[model samples]
Target: MGKPTGFIEYLRELPVDRTPTERVKDWKEFHHHMEEKKLRQQGARCMDCGIPFCHTGKLISGMASGCPINNLIPEWNDLVYRGLWHEALDRLHKTNNFPDFTGRVCPAPCEGSCVLGLNNPPVTIKNIEAAIIDRGWEEGWVVPEPPAVRTGKKVAVIGSGPAGLSCAAQLNKAGHSVTVFERADRPGGLLMYGIPNMKLDKKEVVLRRIKQMEQEGIKFICNANVGDNVEPQIFLKEYDATVICTGATQPRDLPIEGRQLKGVYFAMEFLGANTKAVLDGGAEHALISAQKKDVVVIGGGDTGTDCVGTSMRHGCKSLVQIEILPKPPTERAADNPWPEWPKVYKMDYGQEEAAAKFGADPRVYLTTVKKFVGDEQGHVKELVTVEIKWEKNEKGQFIPKEQPGTEQTRPAQLVLLAMGFLGPEQALLKEIGVETDPRSNIKAEHEKYTTSIKGVFAAGDCRRGQSLVVWAINEGRGAARECDRYLMGYTDLP
Candidate 1:
């Protein structure tokens, strides 16, 4: 422990965010870093508890409770408090291959399970983590560490998202020649396209890491869709082992009336096209602008929140978000206790900006859209919605029951569906002959990570269904270790 009484002496502090009005004008990241001295003070708040539940990486009540990649939270915090940033970065990289991505996007289950958070605020672990990695980049501490000896084994990773990148990185470190295939024109999957640039700078952060991985001998082939452009049988014939990490990209659809309106689009379609256009020298083509339009985003999740933020940047005239589920409590309910991720309401960046501009949060809970009303031009003009109540049907399945006299019509120029993904697209999996679970996810044991076919493994969203980036990294590393074991009949990777 850097200071035995540090937790008692210091309260948690975090980086400040740019003001709503100012940040909404640009697509750059809005988070401002704290001073080095104050950041050290925040790191000092780590109590170094005897158990240190923050890094346990366990699941409780079906939700993650700590760092999913098992980062050495206390050790890194102590190092940061003592101004040992390079050492802190080294320790942070020991488990997590990409702390920058998780630091920005993760919900921070570690903070929820922090020993200090039982009473006071939790240690600024995520902030400290981002600081360490950013410092490492600035100081030129991060570099390619290619394995010394070649194993003469080649592996194919069929995705370029966090999971695929992590798997390829680890396998390369184990002296295996690894090649990653991405169907998109660019790599990084959702990290490159699904996410907006303001949240994660594409060139500065993500592509920098990609360059380093390439230098470390990991090959990334873009615009190659296995089972389509590149034959799946060719991979099985050429590579010694194949690891599938294609993320859950299949979007859920709203099958209501007037669904085919020109102005309506899937959340990914809007976000992806906008990002691609931004990256293409700010081209007008493939861009979805919300300027002077009334926008309605369906579903209440991260993707929905991203839509809210993105629309605000486009100078939308009005915005409304609808959620079928009831609003969460402001505080943890009696059913949700300590050490579990709390199901409570919090204003994310998008809602914060919307509230600042519109005078209230834009989300309306327990509301279901019945149809997208369109004009003579075939563009969506309004949304017909009704309040709903959850009731158990004869089969005991909870279904939405429309409440009487609760119907309303709201004006809208654009509607984005963000209800989440179904599963990985089935074309590649079917061509590869991998079995899928009942949920349509690729069948693979969590620990072994082996598919029904020998020499083939699966991980990440494709294997585990839609999940967070941290879980994807965890499964990727686990699958890499298992692949190594299968190649050598034993392995040393953790």
Candidate 2:
């Protein structure tokens, strides 16, 4: 603890985000970095609590309690406070292979479990983490560090999402020849396509990491579909071992009446195309445009918010986001105690942008869509919605029950379905002959990562179901360690 009483002296403060109204016009990252002095002060606020739950990485109440990758948060906080920037990065890279990604996108469950958060505001751990990694890049401290020796054993990693990238990176670090296969044209699976550019700049942030990985001797083969273009049996012929990091990508669909109407798309279809358009030349070249159209975004999650933001950029005439669940409380509920992920209400970047432009939050709570109304051309024109209440069924599971006389119609030209994924697509798993759980996720033991197949392993959303980026990294690293042990009968990966 560089500053023993620092927690009492400093208060939590984050860098001001670019104003919503101004930022919506351009596709740039909206978050501004804090100055070094303020970042050091924020780092100093890490308390000397003996049991620092900030990095405990436990699941409480079925949600993440702290850093899922077990990041040495307090150690790096102290390192930053002592003005040891290089050492801070060393400690950060020890656990998280990509702090830059998690620092931008992770919900920061670590802060929810911070000891200082019992009464006072928690330390700005997320901001400090982003600062540390961003600093490392600025100072040229981050570069390729290929292993000094090669083990001659080759490993193939499927899917270039967070899990696959981390798994490939770890296996490469263990001196094994690693090759990553991506179905998309680009390497980053979710990070490249799922997230919008304004949230995380693709050319500057995501591609930069991809280039670094390439320089480190990890080969990436793009547009390679194992079950289709590439043979699944190639693993047993060439690679010493295979690791499946293909993510949960099967989006849940709203199969109500008129679902076949035109102008309705899944969130990934909209988001992925937009990024591809931006990378191709200009956002104006997007496959589907929301310009001058009334947009209705279904499902209220990060993907929904991304749809709202993307629509705003496309100059949509009207925007509304529908959430079937009730609005969360402004503060933590009694049942959501400290150290648990607080189910508190906070406007994300998209909602803030919508509120600034539309004079209100765009989300409609306690509402469910009954059906999509189509025009003569068979394109979506409007949708009917109804208010609903949660009721327990005979199985003791909560379900939404629509209220009578509450149905209403709203005009919409474009509809984006952003409900969460059900599980990974089954084609590749079936071809690979890996067993799946009842929930359709790959059936591999959590820490062990081994599957029914002798040389095959699974990790990330494919194994654990859809989850946060940090958890994907944790699973990927764990799978790498286990795979290394299986390959050599001794594991050295951490």
Candidate 3:
């Protein structure tokens, strides 16, 4: 609303990123900052719609349609446009505890549902969002605001990923003493290790927020794994309430032949080790390196893309990513209408890097790895793949059918499985006697976030299965709200 014709006048623009060829040499963040004037122009592109769908936060066709945390998109857009920098940050913090993380990582479903996207390109919500928070940090406006008075209550948050951080943050804001326990050597759980450093820098961005949370009086206990060294029952005994945000760490495995080869590794295993090496003064020699190797990534998702990017940084000789599903259409098909996530084709950062060197996209659609070929040392040397076609079975379920004469054997010294996660690891839940859904997730209702066990709550991927970081933050805040109500018999958290 800052400029009535802003939507019509401004075109979509994104911040320039480091070229794929040059950025592949190092692990630094590739995204660059846009000048304030250009950023305001991007913010002005947000149409002052009669009914904004950008923040509706609904699920359509089994995918997120808008901002999962219901971010005040229009308000912040206007604030940024009108040069009310502080006001914009205030509005962003009202819903999102970490705009910097979301702006960098979240897929921005809000853009898919933008009203302006019906005709023209949607507003540059993601870029403008990142700019606003980055500016706040540069201006020193972001600081810890610990609660004024303690409520004399204590809460324990298990895990320190996006959900755990947001949950602990909100619980701390409610004037309750909050403690977050993470099993990792460093905090941030998935944020710390699951994602590569290039996507979310640990020291600069993730840890910066962690330091602020420490200042806000939230205690983080690292290397305190509940089911192993630290007793799970201690939380039930020592804290008034407990919220489990341990996320879906159990990765899905491809149980194929030669899976036991020494060179084959889980996506998390590869990504986690590489990030640790990057942070620990480049001790990458101790960890597995894709340097001078022909790497094959099994599964096509963000993790697969991360593998490609990480391998490129390690100076891999070649790269290939295999996908079981067919390639997505270039544009939305007949069934994929507006307000739903657009199932279209777009190359991510990893593919960009791979293509920059290899001269083509590294992904091959409708292909599945048949088996891996290993050398005498039990190290993977090659993999055989076969093209497949989806066909309906008698039960009307589509299943992959191998296409004859389509098998191809390719060189592969390392293989990373990035299919996705199954659910949260079950040892701690079983140790605590918490019930789990059939899907192996914690049996907690949405919004309420309470488990069958009294005084126990669950949220994020642990409760809802594998999802985006924005959704995890949404669940974290929602779980904090319910936990507050349960403890105090009322709540004011939104």
Candidate 4:
């Protein structure tokens, strides 16, 4: 404990965000960093709990309770509080390969499980983490460190998302030649396209990391679809080993009346194309646009929130988000407590923007889309929804049951289905002859990561199903460690 009373003296604080109305005007990041001295004070709020749950990295109640990468949170907090930023960055990099991405997008399970949160607000761990990494970049402290010697072993990584990138980076650090294949025009799979630019600046953050990885001797090949353009046998014959980080890209579809409507689209098709157009020039080539239209988003997860935010930026006339689950409580219920993700009502950025523009919280819980109504041109014109209740089925599983006499219809020119992903696209897995689990995810045990095929391993969403980017990094690093052992009969990478 740097100062025994530091936690008592300092309080939790974070960077202020730009006003929703102002930030919605442009697709740029809104959260501004706190001044350095203020940030150090925030870092001082760390209590140095003897058994710090903030870094436990355990799965409690089926959700991550702390830093999944097992970041040295307390050590770095102490370092930053003492004005040792360079040392803080070093401690952060010891575990997380890319704290920049997590600092922005992660839901901060660490804060939720912080011991201090039992009595007061948790330490501003995520903000401190982001500040340390951003400072490292500004000071030119983050640079390529290619291995001094090559191991004469080559590894092929399919997918350029966080998992594949982390895997390839770790293998390269161990002196193995690594090549990443991405089907998109650019690398950084979800980071480049799936996520909004305002949350993570692609050019400044994602591409910068890619550039460093390139300088570190990791090769990235774009526009290469492994199952279609490039044959799986090529990797098997050419590379010493292969790692499949092809994330769960298959979106769950809403099978309903008028599903073939023109304006109705999957959330990724909308988010991916918008990001592409943003990078290319504007939304000129965007396949779907919500401009001057009533937008209805199905699902209430992060992806749905993203859809709402994107629609607001497009100047949508009105917006409504529907979720089948009931609304969470404003505060944690007696059944729910700290050390687990609080199932409490909290407004995300998208909801905040929607409220600012539309004069209401757009989310309508316990409601589901029943059908879509389209105009003569087949473009969606309205959405039919109904209230639903959870009831036990014959098998004792809770299922959504539509309530009678509760049908409602609303104007909606654009309908975005952000119901989440099903599993990895099976074409590549089928081509590679890998077995799949019951959920259709590539069948690989956690940490073991080895697929049925010899010298072929799986990690990330493809293997474990949809999860956080931090979990992807964890699986990627674990897969690399096992792959290294497989290639050289021993391993050092972690």
Candidate 5:
């Protein structure tokens, strides 16, 4: 509450991003910086509500309603309004271990739950958050603060994504020797490989944080799969405690007709290979290429968007994204009121780029693949699709019902399955004999992080199923606090 009338005086504003056409040409971040005065004005829009739901991080209607890490929203808002960016960064770091990552990638449930959003637009909390951390980095305010003393205990984190990184970071801050093992060539599991570089610059943002963590005495062992390359039993013997943050990576498959076609690939396979080639400067080794091809991406989430963006960069001649669900309302519907995640339609970056090039939004909602029609050489040449409607089954379950006479075919040389992940791969969990929930996620209660076995802990997507980076950081920090408590008699970590 830097200014009492701030919300009344200022309208919400975000930094301008490069035009879609221009940004599609390169794999760099698009959003530019806002001037200090305008940024402070955006921060001032945060209403000084007596009950700030923006920071509550509660679940409403089975969806996250605010900052999942319970970031001190108002305090930082006030700090940003007062132009105390370093202080704002400090406050942000108090709860979220990686605001840099979240600021770029998070869907900002905080804005959805803002008190001001009941009528006016919500405050630009995400933009202000990114600004604070970016300012910290620019001013050299952020640095490694390794623990002053050793706890004489060792902990092993099995993933290098947000959860594993945050868990390793917090545990190391508690004076424990922490080691993170990542199977990828470099660290930052999904952050490094799963996501495209343009959305989150791998070198400047992700790896920079990793370098600081390394300087803080956290050891990252890359290209090491704990359950396969190394043994799970070895962790039990070598380390005093082991925290498994292996993310939910088992991608869902569309087992339709002609599934074995040459050009068909999992979304991760495409995204992962594209990122690897981009980083390694070896585009020739890319697993799949959308260049000069008609591409069809199946699904309509962030991953699907990534596929579209990546395809656009590869100079795909034509592209279409098929989504099984119906299109969302342009604005919040009557059933979706304030303080809940508004299930509304908003074109994301990839769709924006696709629309810029293709002259229309590429999504075909309420449609799904019937089967693949391939050429004589076994390459996908076209997709047979059918329109569908949601209908209640005998058991009162809503399922897709193909509408009669709604079948059609579209040319597609390459088909990328952007359907979401099922859960963590079961190999490691089964090898370690960890219990699993009905969803096939690790059977550990939320916030506790304890597995069925003593001295073993699980967190992140592996424990909670596929989720946002913000949620992963929340679970990671929570797991670290619990792990610290288990190792020592108490934990000072929040």
Candidate 6:
């Protein structure tokens, strides 16, 4: 530890963000950077516990409890606390290939499981991480380190999202020739499209990294969809190994009445189109503008929150997010103890922005849209909703029972389906002859990352179903290590 009593002496602190009203006007990052001195103070808050659960990367109750990439949290925390930023950056990059991405978007289970959090607030590990990387970029310390010699073994990675990028980077470092294929016009799959620009700036942050990777000798091919635009057999014929990192992009649909309404759209379609428009000179052809519209977003997850934020950016007249599940307690429930992820109610950035714009938070708990009410032109104009209560059915299965007299109709001009993803589309997997689990995810064991087809591996959302970006990166790194091992007799990759 940098300071023996650092945990006791200092408290947790995070960087300030721009006001919601000020940030909504443009597509730029809202977070303000902290001064170096203040960052050191935040870093000093790291207890770096004897049994650091933050780096364990274990699963409890089917939820990730710590850094899934097994980041060397304690070592880097100490380095930052001592003001040895270059050393901190080195340690941070030792495990995570992209601290910049995780530092901004990750929910930070590390802080949730922090030993200091047992009594006081946890250390600002995530902010310190971002600071280290940003500093590395400013100082020009981060440079391309291509492998001294190539192994002459070729590998193809499908999808240029976090998983595919990390896998390709690691494999390239291991001296294998790696190429990434992206279906989108640009690389970074969901990173470049599914995610809104305000949360993660595309040019300043994401593309900067991609440019660096290009310099590192990793080849990226855009507008290439295996089994569609490009033949699947070409990979098998050309490359020694293939790793599929295609994310779980097949969105789950809400099969309710008036689903064919014109104003109704999938969350991905809206977000993707918006990003594409923003990148294409800030104007869209089929503009799905929320301006002056009463927007209702179905499903209260990250995607729903993103829709809420995006709607606010478009100057929506009003907004509401419907969640079927009951609201979580303000604090952990009796059954949920510390070190387990705190199942408490918290306002995300989008909700915070919505609350600032409106008088209250937009979420309606224990409610779901029964149907969409559309005008004569088949444009969604309202939503018919009903409150529901959970009860055990005859077969002992939990079912949502509609509460009588709770039916109501609310004004809505636009309805966004933020229900979530089902799994990877089956067509490509079928064409490639890869086995799938009962869940329809590519059949690959955790850590091993091997498909039923030899010399072919699967990882990320496609292999493990819908998951966090951190988990995807973990899967990518693990899959790369396994792929490298398969390429050679043994491997030294970690």
Inter-residue clash pairs, candidate 3: none
Q: List the residue pairs that clash in candidate 1.
A: none
Task: Give TM per candidate.
Answer: 0.98, 0.99, 0.99, 0.99, 0.99, 0.98
For each candidate, the alpha-carbon lDDT, in order, equals: 0.92, 0.94, 0.93, 0.92, 0.92, 0.89
Which scores higher on lDDT, 2 or 5?
2
Stretches off by above 4 angstroms in model 3 are: none
Tens digits of per-residue lDDT for model 5 on 318-353? 999999999999889999998998899999999999
Residue 433 Cα positional deviation in candidate 3, in Å, after optimal superposition = 1.1
lDDT per residue, candidate 3, 399-488, as tens digits? 999999999999999999999999999998998888999999999999999999999999999999999999999999999999999999
lDDT of 1: 0.92
Best by lDDT: 2
Candidate 6 lDDT over residue span 1-494, tens digit each:
87888878776777789998898887788889999888888877777679989887777888888889988999988888788989999998999999999888888888788888887878787888889999999999999999999999999999999999999999999999999999999999888998899888888888998998999899999999788889999888999999999999999998989998999999999998888888888823327888889999998999998898888888899999999999999877888777888888999888999999997899999998889888998898998999999999999998999999999999999899999999999998988999999999999998899999999999999998898899989999999999999999798889
Tens digit per residue, CA lDDT, model 1, 28-73: 9888889999989988899889988899878889889998899999
lDDT of 4 by residue, 100-195 (tens): 999999989999999998988889998889999999999999999999999999999999999999999999999999999999999999888989
Any runs in candidate 1 off by more than 4 Å, and if so which?
A: 283-285, 394-397
Q: How close is candidate 4 to the true structure, as a TM-score?
A: 0.99
Pitting candidate 3 against candidate 6, the one with the higher TM-score is 3
